[model samples]
Target chain A: MTQPLTAGVSLKPQHYADALACRAEGLWFEAHPENYMAAGGPRLAWLDAIARDKPISLHGVGLSLAADEAPDEDHLAALKRLVDRYQPALVSEHLAWSMRRGVYAPDLLPFPRTQAALARIADNVDRMQEVLGRRVLIENPSLYLPLEGHDLGEVAFLAALSRRTGCGLLVDVNNVFVSAHNLGFSAEAYLDALPAEAVGEIHLAGHAPDANADLLIDTHGAPVAEAVWRLYGRLIARIGQRPTLIERDDDIPAFQDLMAERERAHALLTRETVDA
Target chain B: MPDGFHDRFLAAVGGDEAALAPWCAGPAASAGLAVYRNTTAKGAADALAAQFPTVERVVGPAWLAAAAVAHAADHPPRTASLLTYGEAFGGWLTTFPPAADMPFLADLARLDWLWTGAHLAADAPPLEATALARLTPESFARYRLVLHPATRFAGFDDGAPSLWQALQPPGDPPADLELGDAPEGLVFVRPGLDIDHRVIGAGTLAFLAGCGAGESLAAAAMDALAAEPGLDLSTVFAGLVAAGAFTELRTLS
Candidate 1:
């Protein structure tokens, strides 16, 4: 908590020693809490070492908050245990749902944003916050299919959810670009519309063209694309400044390669301080 | 009946491609649905590959992925924390027609699963090397040697343990996937960060089993000798002690 986190890279096990040894200012690490839910292991010990020097963010991917039912109590308890142990600088989950009917799909599966759906998700978020005794940021999901029967737009729905539950947003800039291209909307317009106050964290990751379709998949396998970087720049300019993360889940490169990208975000985030 | 949008979309992603028509229109519909389906399958496949590395290495990536996709249909992940997913995969493999030819695969999978259990089991300090040395023969009969929280062991009808150990690095590739007729077992002990695994003898397996069942040292030793009369009890117990297998002695109050 001594140095404000300007930007961070997603922590991978391979880079644990480097992450711990690095002296970069504001270089925190984000991790999927699901990966560290084990009772005991070297993974937890590694996190403890790195987190001692740098901030750690427990960005959960499996809470399934948008599911119709209350978020799974056991998942919430596991999350609570992590929150208590790490005291993470920020915690977040997606606006999408993956668990349904006792079956959990791995992807951030979408749901029709209806008025009823809104109520269910709000309650789910409430339960998550209540159980953890903290407010969590909800990241927007990248849309693939355009579903009918939505009661609100993505921005409006998120805004409403924030108003109702006092949660924040972890906007993944690449998701905006990909969703807008697939759903036939303006990426810039979507960024402009997000309530600046609700913006708590930002994510930048790579995407690839779907082999069989006219869609961009959030592969996180490659480096951040040019267009997404532009969107991230525009978003931070509007929202002033927030903790940003560079996520590379698959096809990870060397620690130095990711730090180069992290430095880009960090430089942009800091320049705003001088300008303002 | 499928209840609503959540239910219907899940069904579409679950394969009823026609169900995608209601949510999306035209060619884009199928393509979008395909993306979801592929992503879902890839997620499960990737987790499975990591969970059962030896299986993947033996059967090849393509075959393992095929099996993972098929197994997921009936036993889709019940939880999103996938580190421990595929709990039933070992048993499920027995019923998988493809695995009928490779009869040893089920036991291999079970061995792989035990490795994961030991990897994530709770941490605890091992018993002092000489905790049993000072015990009176009379007192030893009433006391138990407690297994460490991170200790795991399993017996196999075939040589699955030896096969798995062969698949580990520094060791050459195994000769074949053929199951040896001789019965074997494996034991895992994590003294520190690194886990130590060894192909255990039948007597050692029986001794650990008795300890796991909460039997006294004297009783377990009897079973160990019974299982393998030639098992040098002193040397075997000392070897287990050196491996950091037991946490403490459960003494009578």
Candidate 2:
């Protein structure tokens, strides 16, 4: 806890043993709380064992905060239980909604950034903070199809939400890159517009170009792209160091391979700190 | 208004392209929507495959993946926790025309679902065999045993349980999976990190059914005896107790 927030990797069940045995300094782990919502099982047991020694972050992908309806109480209660049990250093969710009525779509579906949508999402963030008794970092969603009716840009919308809800922002650099390319915007300009002081954490993951289309898909199946790594360096240089995560959800390689990418981020963070 | 944004976006994702036309910056947006559609479908398909490993084994990954996509279109997940999704897949497969040749496929899917349930059920310290010896014969008659939270038992009229059990270990399934007329039972328990399952006899199945129904030990034994006239009640009960199936024994006060 004394060390600065260092680089970490998404904790996959396949890499539990390696994660536990990992000895890199300031190395921590992140896991999607939705995956561990079971009543009891080996998944929770493995997480408990890993949390015993390292800092854990509960990054949620299914809370559906942007849905028109209120956040699911059961999902919130389960998330609270995980946060209470694991005591993760950082808790985070997305700016997108996935559930409509009772049916859930696994992807982080987007919504227009209008004033009404902002008010609703801010209220959801407030409710989430009140229930968890802590502030959470809301992440930017990777854009696929651009939508109309938006009253604010993505960065402005995030900043406004932060101002209203007293929550922090998780700047996902890879999401910024993919969204910019797919939506015809400048990634650098988008990152620059982010309120640096409101930023509490950073996320770096992989993306692939669509097979039959020119759009970029946030696949998270491969290693962090070089372009994303460069963006990570640039963002850290601008905003200083924050806890960063290297996420790979599909086609997961060996634990050592992920750690190597994590180590690259760690090295950059260390160098940034030295330069400062 | 933004209130209409979600509805339109959802419609566009659901293939109502014209609904989101105003939102589309250009023609590139159409391909972008395809990415979302493909990703959502992949998510549901992956969850179904994970939940039903035995089904995947029987149908193979390619076949299962395609069926999963079709099934997901009809039955999307109701919760973000995909671990417990695909509850209706087993029954749905029974009506799937492709599976008409495999009558036991639905039963196999049901067993797979049970396995998932057992794997994720609440964890508790299992009861020891010594706990059972403390009860007097009179007390045992009125005492009801509580099965562990991870306990799952089911009876099959065909040899599906045996087929499912054989397919568990890594390798090609048996060359000849002839559907026999033998009625069998399977019991699943997760004493520790791993889920273990085994096939059982009709008497044991009846005993488990009675226990699950909160029947007294004496009554459960009677039911077991009736189910299999030559049942060794003591051995069957002792085996279940030794398997760490019971969590506690409560006397009905």
lDDT of 2 by residue, A193-218 (tens): 89999999899999999898888889
- Checking candidate 1 for backbone clashes, the offending pairs are none
DockQ of 1: 0.67
Name the runs in model 1 displaced over 4 angstroms.
Answer: B1-3, B170-172, B175-179
CA displacement after TM-score superposition, residue A230 of candidate 2 (Å) = 1.1
Candidate 2 global CA lDDT score:
0.89
| Worst-scoring 10-residue span by lDDT in model 1 chain A | A142-151
* Cα-based lDDT at residue B147, candidate 1: 95
* Model 2 chain B: ten consecutive residues of lowest lDDT: B1-10
Of all native A–B interface contacts, model 2 reproduces a fraction of 0.83
Candidate 1, chain B, TM-score (2 decimals): 0.94
